[model samples]
Target: TQLLEQSPQFLSIQEGENLTVYCNSSSVFSSLQWYRQEPGEGPVLLVTVVTGGEVKKLKRLTFQFGDARKDSSLHITAAQPGDTGLYLCAGADGNKLVFGAGTILRVKS
Candidate 1:
């Protein structure tokens, strides 16, 4: 079985501070996805990286897929308090999805 492991289980930062979280796996995936989950809402798909070495940016956030397709990272620039939430990384392997433990982010005002 393949598993995604996320680093820095928790992150607490002040508004405007930049941070980066990582997701890694031993298995290669065809595609990987990033999601953000707020307190009461289900996770919303943020981005999906299919090609290795691809980089995608959404506003102040950037998502990157590893050259080997076995790792990924999420970086936020000048983060705001509104960004506080649980960030998850999932790898799509064939018909199954393997999820990371998730990183909890708390951005203080």
Candidate 2:
């Protein structure tokens, strides 16, 4: 089984600051997905990157897939308090999908 390792595990930053979280794996994935989960809600899909060296942006958030498709990163620019949540990375290869431990972000106003 393949697993994703995410770091630094937890992040606390002031509003308007920029931050980056990472997800890495020893195995390459066909596609990678990023999700955000709130207090009482299920994780919501943020973005999916399928091609190597691909980059996608959603407003203040940016997602990037490594050239080998074994790593991914999420960058938040001028993060707001609303960005505080659990960030998860999931990788899919054929019929299997694996998720990282997740990074909890706390943005203070």
Candidate 3:
């Protein structure tokens, strides 16, 4: 079975700080996606990385896919309180999606 493990399950930082979170797996995936979720809401797709070593940026956020396609990372620059949310990494396996344990981030103003 494909599985993803995310590091630092929880985080707390001040506004304007930067942080990076990681997702790792032993199994290779055809594609990987990142999502962000707010309290009481479903996760919103942030970006999708298909090729190995691919990187995508959205404003202050950066996503990277490992060269082996088994890992990924998310970096936030000058985070704001509004950036606080649950971040998740998911891998595509056939018709199914294998998700990581998700990282919860809190940015205090």
Candidate 4:
């Protein structure tokens, strides 16, 4: 069975601080995606990494896939209160997706 593990299940930081979250897995995946979600709403896809060592950035957020395709990371720079939300990593297994437990981040203004 494929499984994804996310680190630092919860985080609280002041605005302008930076943080990095990680996702790891023993099983290889064809693709991996990152998502951010606010309370009472569905997660929104942030980025997808398909190639090993690929990196994608969205404004102050950066996503990187491990060279071996078994891990990924997300880094945020100068966080704002609006950045507070749940961050998730999902690995593609054929047509199904294996999701990490998710990391909750709260940025206080």
lDDT of each: 0.96, 0.96, 0.95, 0.96
lDDT string for model 2 (15-36, tens) is 9999999999999999999999
lDDT of 4 by residue, 1-109 (tens): 8889999999999999999999999989999999999999999999999999999999999999999999999999999999999999999998888999999999999
Off by over 4 Å in 1: none
lDDT score for residue 26 of model 3: 98
Model 4: colliding residue pairs:
none
Runs of candidate 2 with Cα error greater than 4 angstroms are none
Q: How accurate is candidate 1 locally (lDDT)?
A: 0.96
Q: What would the per-residue lDDT of candidate 1 be over residues 59-109, giving only the tens digit for each residue? A: 999999999999999999999999999999999988778899999999999
Q: Give TM-scores for every candidate, taking all chains together and pairing residue i with residue i.
A: 0.98, 0.97, 0.98, 0.98
lDDT of 2 at 48: 93
Worst 10 residues of 1 by lDDT: 92-101
Model 3: per-residue Cα lDDT over 1-109, one tens digit each: 8889998899999999999999999999999999999999999999999999999999999999999999999999999999999999999998688999899999999
Candidate 2, 106: how far from true, in Å? Answer: 0.4
With a 3 Å backbone cut-off (N, CA, C), the pairs that clash in candidate 3 are: none
Q: Which TM-score value belongs to model 1? A: 0.98
